[model samples]
Target: MNTTPTIDVPVQVLSGPTVLIEYAGLRILTDPTFDEPGEYPVMPGYAMTKTSGSPLGTDEVGRIDAVLLSHDEHDDNLDRSGRAFLPRVPVVFTTISGAGRLGGNAKGLAFWDEATLTAPDGTVVTVTGLPARHGPEGSEPVSGDVVGFLLTAPGHPSVYVSGDNASLDYVQQIADRCAPIDTAILFIGGVRHKPMLDAQLVTIDNTQATWIARALQARRVIPAHFEGWAHFQGTREDLTRTFEEAGLADRLTYA
Candidate 1:
């Protein structure tokens, strides 16, 4: 086990909305979507297409201590391969309703709820659930429940993982609650389903992402979920340009 506290935490962006976070001697995976490019049925008439494959396979991830699932209802976030990978993991933290549906080894967390886990080196790490809205106001009933995450440990930089959220108001709330976030793994795809929610982004766009970084005062911002999906409206290039124009390019972790 690596007991040394890292000043710069390592984050690996596997694919859309999937990121592997290494902090405080713990290996945490966020929204594991390992399946290859294909179409996934969301509802009777609605389906989401994955246009790319994950950079790493499940076997390559080694040992994942916990899975931070923002929401389970969306296939783009948790596909067939991702679902299969869950049981192998020791624990999964997700929305309250998602936990109930997932059952075994899955624990539901309401907004602001915190869960403590011991790291490989016996260091204590706390993960707190944060608010998230998948779509416009009053869209929760149809869009399903979603939640972000905040990770904290003594003598370590705090980490924030934004789920599929679009509301800047929610970001403000998170900032007010947990400001000065050291690192932020943001989900930014600018997803738009015309029939479902006209012109409304399911996740934060480039502009909103920039605001989120400023609001949280994040030292390092790792962008994900901004590519490899059919519904996504924004791209990495756009995000880079947006941040650069805003004079925040220095804070981005393009790697």
Candidate 2:
């Protein structure tokens, strides 16, 4: 019997854009929003009071090695419950302003700074923070500081977690910093509602996501930030068809 080796890189979709990546036995939670009833609101599109997806209570998740905040403004990425659980964990990595906001709860990692987060097997993993553009181009007032992460494991596949962003230039920049990427999780949602059809308002719709994924030359492209809210317009089917049409079906991987 040919036994297939189990790829231990486990990824659990907690909610909307939130995910738990268990790589090398290290449990890393990205953009955790575990609020019940999903009360926190982000932008005009996304909000959560919890009870949206899997019920991941604090006890159920066990211990988390590190928490990646990316940017602290969005509720989808940051929630009250997640914020409350900050001091409980050993290390919390995010922006300086966000940490200050936490009030002794967690520490902040400056943008582009690299830190070693211990793995489950005692091996150290390197996490690099990359820049991200939130909201529209040339519109910094409404848009906040969004960041991405490069999770690197020596001799293993490295992953890029694209927080809520849509700019192709930002995607290209991430690729420039970390080329030959093994995997990339792009936040793909065409989030559109009444009276807001302008390109400046909506982030990575189907077209933009496809372009960025292809530009990154990622071995595997995973789509996130959809299906858990009513405001998010993009769907898995939309991604599937787009990738297929772009001739990147082989490269695209849907969660």
What is the TM-score of each predicted model, taking all chains together? Answer: 0.95, 0.85
- In model 2, the runs with Cα more than 4 Å from the true position are 1-8, 38-51, 192-202
Candidate 2: the clashing residue pairs are 36-49, 37-49, 37-50, 38-48, 38-49, 38-50, 39-48, 39-49
Q: Write the per-residue lDDT of candidate 2 for residues 1-255, one digit (tens) a residue.
A: 011122335677777777788766788888777766545554476443333754587668887878877767767677767767767777777776667777564666665888887776777788887777666676545656677788876655777888877667777877676776767777777764333335454357877777877677677777777667666775678778888998888877655
Candidate that would win on TM-score: 1
**Full-model lDDT, candidate 2:** 0.70
Clashes of each: 0, 8
Residue runs of model 1 more than 4 Å from their true location after superposition: 1-6, 43-46
The alpha-carbon deviation from the true structure for residue 226 of candidate 2, after best TM-score superposition, in angstroms, is 1.3
Q: Model 1 compared with the native: what TM-score? A: 0.95
- Computed on alpha carbons, the lDDT of every model, listed in order, comes to 0.89, 0.70
